[model samples]
Target: MKKVFLLILVISTLAVASQLEIFSSSGEWAFFENPARLLSMNKQGVMGSYQVFSGEGESLGTFLVGLFQTPAPNIAGVLYLKRSTLTESSYRTTIEYDAAFSPEESLNVGAGVSFTMDQEERKEIDLHGGVSGYLFKDVGFGVSVRDFTLWSQKGTYMGGTYLLKLFYDSSRKNRFSYSLVFDQEVLENRIDFTIGSEQKAGLGVSVLSNTKTKENTVKISLGFYATVNNVSVGFGTFIISSPVSSDPFSEYYYTQGTGIKFAVRW
Candidate 1:
C-alpha cells in the first residue's frame, strides 16, 4: 500500500488529540479550537495538560502546556503546545494560539493558527473561528469554521468544520451551564456530535460520536481552578473499531492527544 501522508505518524497524533478539545467537544470553545465555553472564563488563566491514547492496544503518551486569557473583559486569547511519544519514539509536537473579541457580551469572534511538526518538519496548520450567544433565556447557539488541512477532512477537504450548540443553564449568572454540540466536517466525513455539561467550581462530562458510522467516544472531564484557585482535569476514550477500524495497512501512522490539565491564574 502506498504510504498516504494522512496516515503519517504526525497525523495520527492529531487524530487522538482530537478527543481532548482543550476546551469542549461542543464548540463552546468555538472562538478557537478549545470550545466556546472554555472562553467563558475569558479572564487570564493557565494550565498544564497530559493525555494518553491507545489504538489497537498500542498506547501513546502526550504532554501539553495550555494557557488563555481575556485581554479585556470582552477579549480573549489562548496558547498551547503538545509534546508526544509513541512507545518512547519521539513523534510530533504542536503549537497554537487564538485571540478573540466579545461584543455586547453576547457575541464572540476569533481566529487561531497551529504549527505541527513530525521529524521536526512542518506537518500541519489548523485555523478556526466561531460565534456564540443566547437568543433568549436558556437558549443559545454557536457556529464555527476551521481551516483544517486536506488530510484531516479527507479528499473533499473544504479545510473547514462547522459546529452548533444549544444549551440551558440552571443558573443564568454564567455560573453553571450545559449544552449539546453538533459539529460536522462542513463537507466531509460523518456528523461529529458532542454533549457536555459543566458547573462553576470546576467539573464536567462529555460524550462525542459519529452519526453515520455509529462509532462513539465518551469522555469525562474536570477542571479545578483552585490550583491557581481552581483545578482542571479530563479523560476520554473512542470506539475506533466500530466503523472505520484503525488502518491495519496504516504505514504512515499518526496519533492524537488528550488528558489531565492544571492551570494557574495571576
Candidate 2:
C-alpha cells in the first residue's frame, strides 16, 4: 500500500477559534506570504484579514478559513481556526493564537499555542507550543512545534505538526519582489519541501516535493494577491504528477484552489 499520508488532508471541517489581522496595512506585505501577494494597502496602521480556502489532494477535500493581523510598528496579535476530517478519522479542530513584541528597531520575538481534541491512543504529542522572531533588513523567520505535549486519545495515535517559514523582500515602489518557504515533519520520518518566488504587480510560482524516494513527487505552485481601497484578495494553485507508490491505480491525485482574503485597519 502507498503511504500517501498527505497529512494536511483535513481541508473540509474543523472547529477552530481565530483572530483577524490587518497585515495589508502596508503594501510591503501584500501577498500574505502566499506569492499571490500583489495586493496593495496601508503601511503604518492596524489591519484585519480573513481568507477562505478549499481544494483536493491525495485525500478527500480540504477547506479552511483564516483570519489574522500582520506585523506592524507594535506587537501583533493573531488567531486561527483549523478543522481536519478525512478518511476514517473523526472531525479534528485546532485553535491557535500568536502574540508578538518588538524590543529593538529591527528585531521581534513571540510565542503561540494551539488547543485541540485529545486522543488517548496517540499520547505524548498533542499540545503544541511555538516561538517566532524577525531579523534585520526586512527579513523574517518563524518556527513552531505543534503537539509539543503529545496528548493522545482513543486509538488514533494523534501527533502534532511542525511548521517553519522564511520571507524577505524589498519595499521599493514599482519594483520586483521575491520570497521563499520550507515545511517539514516534527518528529517522524517524513519531510515536505518547497521554494518559490513572486513579483510586485502580481505574478509568482513555486515547487513542492518530498525528500524520500518512495514518496518522491513534485508540484508547482502559482499564486497572486492585491488590494483596492482597504480590500485585499488572493488566489493560488498547486499542480503535481500522479502517485508514484506501488499499485499506481490507487486513485492518486494532486491539488489546486482559489482563495479570497479581505482586510481593513481598526
Candidate 3:
C-alpha cells in the first residue's frame, strides 16, 4: 500500500509538471504548445492522439484531437480538444483555439484561448500568445506566454507561464531545439532538449530536466514517426525518473514510471 501510494503521488506530480512546460518542438501538437508554430504547417489536417501512463497499479490516460487549416496564404489556425482521466470518476476536458499570422516570410505571431472544466464542474479560462522568427536562414528563436489566467470560478489567479526557445534546422529536414520554461506560480524552471527529423520515417528523442530542486527529476522520451500519402502515424514511449528519498546508509532512491503514446494525422 505504501509503495502504491508513493507511485501515485510521483506520477501525479510528474503529470502536473509536464503540463507546465512546452513539450512539442514542431508538428500538429506544436501549435497546441506554443501557438506560433501554427504557421509551420503546410497543409490542413486532423490529428488524434492517445497516451497512457501506468505504474504500481495506478494509471492515467489522455486523449486529444486537433484540426488545423490555412484559410489564407499568411494565416493558419487550429482547434483542439483534450480530455484526461485521472480516475474512473475523475476527468478534465479542455478546448482551445489558436491562430497564427505571418506578415513576412521570417516572422510569425500567434495567440490562443482555452477553457477547461473538471469533473466537479470547476471552470477556468487561459490565454496564450507567442512570437517566433528566424535569426538566420536555418536558425530561429521563439518566446511564448501560456496559462495566463483570464478568469477562474474556483481557482486563484496565478501568473502566466513563460518559455524561451531556440532551434536550428539543417536543410529544413532535421531540427535540434532547446527551450527554457518558467512557471511563475510554482516558481520552477525546466529545460527541454529535442532532436528530430520532419521528413519520412524518423526517430527522435527529447529530454526534460527540472532545475528547481537539488534532486532533479528527468523525463526521457523516444519516438518514431512516418508519413505516407498525406497520412502520418507516430509511436512513442517515455520514462520518468524522480528522486524519492535519501537514506543515511544508501544513495538517493529513485522512482520510475513509463508511458506510451499513439498518434495519427490525416
Candidate 4:
C-alpha cells in the first residue's frame, strides 16, 4: 500500500514540474503579437530579431529571421525561421509560411502553417487563419485561429486554439493605437486576456497588462520601439509570477524576462 502511494506522489510531482517547464519556456514575443498585421503591408524587406533571458546564472535565447514578399499589388507573404534554445540539450526550431490578402480597402484575410521540431525528434504542424476588417474609418476588429489543425509526427490530429482581438488606431494622426486581445488554448484549457496600447513618435512607447487563469496574479510588460532612416528596433521586459505549488522540490517563483527586435526596410 505504501509503495502504491509513493508511485502516485511521484507522478504528481512530475506533472507539476512539467507544467512549470512549459511556463518558463514561453516565447519572448508579447501576448498581443499578431502576424496578421502584415495584411496592411506597404513595404517589402527582411528582418532579424534576437532575444535573451537571464536568471539564476543561466540564459535562454531565441533568434528569428523573416522575409517579406509582395508577389503582386496588394498581396503580401512572410516566411519565418526561428530557433529557441534553453541549453544545447533542449531546443526547438520552427519554420512558418504565411500570406495575406486585401480584397478591398477595408477587409483583410490571412492563412499560415508552422512546422516545429524539437531535440527529441518530436514534430508538430499548426494551421492558422484569420480575418480583420475596419468597422468605421479608424476602428477595426480581428479573429485568429491558431493551431486550427494540429498534427503530430505519427499523423495524429490534435485540437485547435483561437484568439480574438479588437483594435483602434488614429489614422488621421498616426500617433496612437490600442488593442484588446483574448486567447484560448483548447488542449490546455487555458485562457488569457491582454490590453495593450502604443504611443508613437520617432520613438514609441508600448505597454500591456495580461491576466490568465492563475489565481491572484497579473503579468505586466513595458516596451519601446524606434525607427530611423528605414531601420526599426524594439525592446521589452515582462514580470511573471509562478503558479502555486506545494511540492518542496519545485523551483517555482517570480521571474522576469527581456526581449529585443530589429528590422530594416526599403
Best by TM-score: 3
Alpha-carbon local distance difference test for all models: 0.48, 0.36, 0.62, 0.51
Off by over 4 Å in 4: 1-32, 53-59, 154-161, 172-214, 243-254
Error of 4 at 149 (Å): 4.5
Residue pairs of candidate 3 with colliding backbone atoms? none
**lDDT per residue (tens digit) for residues 1-266 in model 4:** 65445334433432322111111101222211344546554566665565555445545566676767667776778888887777444777888888878888888777889998878889988887777777888776666666554778847565554555454556633423343333331111222222222222222122222234343334445555555554555666655453222211112222455665544555
The parts of candidate 1 lying over 4 Å away from their true place are 1-38, 88-90, 150-161, 173-258
Worst 10 residues of 2 by lDDT: 12-21
Candidate 3, 142-250: lDDT as tens digits: 8999879999986677577788878777766666666666554222233434344543232333333333443455555555555554555555555556432331111
Candidate 3 regions exceeding 4 Å error are: 1-23, 184-214, 243-266
TM-score per prediction, in order, is 0.61, 0.53, 0.75, 0.67
Q: Which model scores highest in lDDT? A: 3
lDDT of 3 at 75: 93
- Candidate 1 achieves a global lDDT of 0.48
Q: Return model 4's CA RMSD, one decimal.
A: 14.2
Instruction: List the candidate numbers ranked by TM-score, top first.
Output: 3, 4, 1, 2
RMSD of 2: 11.1
Q: Per-residue lDDT tens digits of candidate 1, residues 102-178?
A: 66567666667777676546466667667777777665666666545534322244334565555554445233344
Residue 236's lDDT within candidate 1 is 41
lDDT of 2 by residue, 82-125 (tens): 55444445445666554555565444455555566522223222
